[model samples]
Target chain A: MNNVVLKCQSLKKTYKKKNRKLVILKDINYEFKSGHVYAIVGKSGAGKTTLINILGLLKKQDSGKIFILNNDVSKINENKASEIRNKNIGFVFQSFYLDPLLTTEENIKLPMLLNNSLDKIKINERVKKLLKEVELEDRETHFPKELSGGEQQRVAIARALANNPDIILADEPTGSLDPENEENILNILKSLAKKGKCIIIVTHSKTVREYADIVLELKKGILEEVSRD
Target chain B: MKNYLILILKRIIRDFKSRLVILLIALILLLGTIVSINEKTTEEMLSKETYSKYHNRLYQLVKKESYETKKKDIKGIPHIITILHEYNIASEYLSSEEFKTPNTDHTIQAYTADNLSLPKIKYGTNFPDKQGFYMVCPINMYPNSNLSSNNINFKITNKDRIDMQQYLNKTIQFQFENVNNMNIKKESIDIKIVGLYEVNKHSLEDNTCYINESAKKYIYDTLNNDLPSYIEKSNPEAAVIIIDDIKNLEEVESELSKIGYRLDPYTIIDPNFLIETKKINKTYSLILSIICVFLLFLILFKDTKNTLKYNKLLKYLGAKDNHLYLTNLIHNILIILLAFILSLILSFIYRGLLNIIIYFRPFLFSKNEIIFSITYLFKIFITIFISTIIISILNNVYIKYKLNKN
Candidate 1:
């Protein structure tokens, strides 16, 4: 039996520019399942980021149905979307948007704190494990600015995984890293998938595409299966 | 929940030192408004109390023509009495004449004043009943004794006041005609001596018996010499006036003019205490209000500009729009609440300093206070609400514009 965690069907989005319309996403159908890594590779303006935003419930599709674990959430209100985003979805960004004032461990612990689901003792345990998993246990007390770009990205990844969501959405996760840090980040994403969590990465990097269980190309407002690794 | 409160408190302490200067500006401005409101209210109340307490300094005099015409036509103390009484201005009446009481060769000054505007009693009750129609004799109504100050100094050896207390509840007859000793028909009436009052510097009288207006006709008859006058017995010898307030002096004078008194160019005695105090209180109160509102607005403007940076990062994290909104509402409310508390402390300190100085210069402030009325409470809530909304929107919009620009 196939377990689908997130899927979008016939997704469409449009932007209005003065008197004209610009179509961003059209006739896109995809399914992301458990325990797999899907890499969406595209050029700079290929609607990859827009699709990831739609799938994460941060933005609404103009015309389509999005199913997350059997629930149609294409047109959910902002409050309901916030609840689902906080409880079930985690995001990792290229720029490593950690609060500059908070320490590394505090950054990792922020999602759970906002969610208010786990106790202090449990959150502490989760923070330590995430710190060790991302290879930043020694730097847990350091602030975001004190770390290198790769270390900031690792803290961002750990924050994304803090609430133990079933799926992780990464937008250019390795785009700003050195080759060594990029490889280390990929190994972390791959390890998460192996541990039965679905990972979706939107990137322009060929190394990320090679590491994916499935690779898809987004071009001309459509997504197509390009290869299987 | 507790953790959230702890975080909020930690954020407060962490931010307090850096924000203290602007916070003090906001606090002082807000407190100016509060203390000004108190000062204005208390001053107004104090003025009104002073007006009511010493209103008898005002007097209304009638023209001789108006008095004579009304006496011939209305058969009473002229139409002005009824008119003044109807308008609630003449709360009580005062008339005085020298009269000899019953079978005794003793004369005493007599007047008419109702319970409301009567003289204060030193020993006995003040106008024992609301409609008490009796006489109050001074204790010094006897031979060679001028006990005007209540401590009896008798030029004669017989210092007693003919034992006036023994005559309580006893009838006293008077020849109720005009005192001018004319051949008018005698109209007699019975009066009872009921109470006695003290003599003081500001006391109404020392050697008079006070009665109500029901006895006014008999005293006026005495002016026609032991007989009832054919026309209304001339105008009252004097009328004691009490005004509602110093502010109402113009209205009272106008109303008196309408009742046929010579008020064409009425000379109004300017109430010195009320005028000066009102000027000082009103000027300071208005200045405080203006300074407070301006400083409070500017402080909020500056604070919103400064804090927008931190809030944007929280919004970027998993915080919803409402999350950021609530954070701002709580944050601004907390600051204003602190300012409000400090304002209260500042007002108390002001009162304390005023009290310290009051002993040396007594007229600086009165005992009237600025109590928290429902209206004031409502104003506080409204000011807080409106200010919070402005600060919240300013912070959110400016941050968004700056971020988008970058």
Candidate 2:
């Protein structure tokens, strides 16, 4: 029996706007096993980001049962959710979302820094290794402003891997990068998946879907498995 | 815990590195120091002024006089001393030199029996023996002069001129002749110059003197021994008394009046004067405190508003509510600590400057040393701490509500 790292049963979220309830996610049932790369694809307002936010424990569903590592997450408080997110999940934003004040190395080490589970020496060693792995060891001291789009996203990738999270949630990770930079980020995500990390990418890019073992589509608040090739 | 604190500290240091926050912190520190030091110094000045005024107004010796016979009534007299003994009252004998001098004409010169050992002596000691010895005079003769000169000239008889310098160690013949042809004589008196005393400059009374109790008794004896019946029936002219409670001087006067001694109703010193002055000082201190608190509140309000804005931005950076609150608290605490230390140094410097002013201009401090009073500093600290906590809590609650609402 394979270990399922995360599962969602009948997850639903709604937003009230101008006296109308707009359903963002509806009856979404999904199971993510360890060591698999999944891609969620949709157009604008298809609720892909909302699904990813719920999966990353950054947002609360109106009604849902979310199980992370066999623990019910929907009943957890914000602090506990944040702790679980910090320990088990990592996020990559479309804009890189690197703290502009910190350097690339500091940005990459932020998760571990916030968690305070690792010493400075270990953090530095891990950051150095990540910098080397991302092919940007020379750019460790460079701030986010000093790095290119590709380099910043690579730093974000390194930050996502800082805590050795069970799952990586990439929300349009390559949306702001050029074609060449896009390939660079895609290859990094694929490489992380090859290392037995579950990679979930929410993106509009068909190229991102090509890298995933399973491609899921979110349409009108309904999630459907489109292809498993 | 240590690692968490270190991380928080690092983040705070980074936040403080911002030029705006750094400048605000510096300004808060500088302003707090100036206000604290000024408040402390002002409180000290006010306290000293009030205390000095109170001390001067309260402490004094009063002597009341009236004749033993021809009973009269006195009531509601201010600051009077009543005597119970009738024979102890002695006559005022003017020396020949003092009688001839125009400067001593209007001066009310009185000689006491030196029974009451008052702390502040106003020039010239009591006569050594109770014999015919007489000291020159008290400072009340020349109340304005603080000079220490002992030389005084006096006339002994209508045809005789004697200087006190010549009679210092010799036996002198003195006579007391009343209007009824009765004469009292004394011989072989040695006069010596003892210690001199100066009255407080704030004293309102004129020239006064103290003679030996024996000398006073001798003069009284001489006047009463050979005097005629009519002269003996008349009032003694000068009387002296010791009072128990200085505060109930009016009651003493009424008590004396019941026994036939009439006192002139004149206020020696205003009793409520010191209390009124202290009330004024307290009012000024209260006003100053209110102004300080108002200005402090204004500064704190503005600081808290800016800090709340920064906290909002920090929250978006993945900081929890506690982290945001602690960061702001640490920042303010650092500024307050720095300001306190700097203010202490400034107060020391101010005290030194005051010392310099006092040294060259001794009259400025009224001969008192200048010292930095920290009583007001404690008040300021408590005020600031209370105000800071209140403002911080209000700001936190407001910001948290606004953010959640958003």
Stretches of candidate 1 exceeding 4 Å from the true structure: A14-23, A62-64, A75-79, A95-163, A173-191, A204-217, A224-229, B1-45, B48-52, B55-114, B118-124, B127-237, B243-254, B260-342, B345-406
lDDT of 2 by residue, A1-229 (tens): 2368889999999989999999989899999877777899888998888888788776788997999989999988766766777778888889887766667877777677667678888988999998888999999788788999999999988888888888898888999999999998988888887887888989888788888888998998888889744
Q: TM-scores across all candidates? A: 0.56, 0.56
Clashing pairs in 2: B96-B155, B97-B154, B97-B155, B123-B197, B140-B207
Evaluated at residue A8, the lDDT of candidate 2 is 98
Rate residue A73 of model 1 by lDDT: 84
lDDT per residue, candidate 2, B147-189, as tens digits? 2222222211222211223333333333334443554443222
Q: Which prediction has the highest DockQ against the true structure?
A: 1
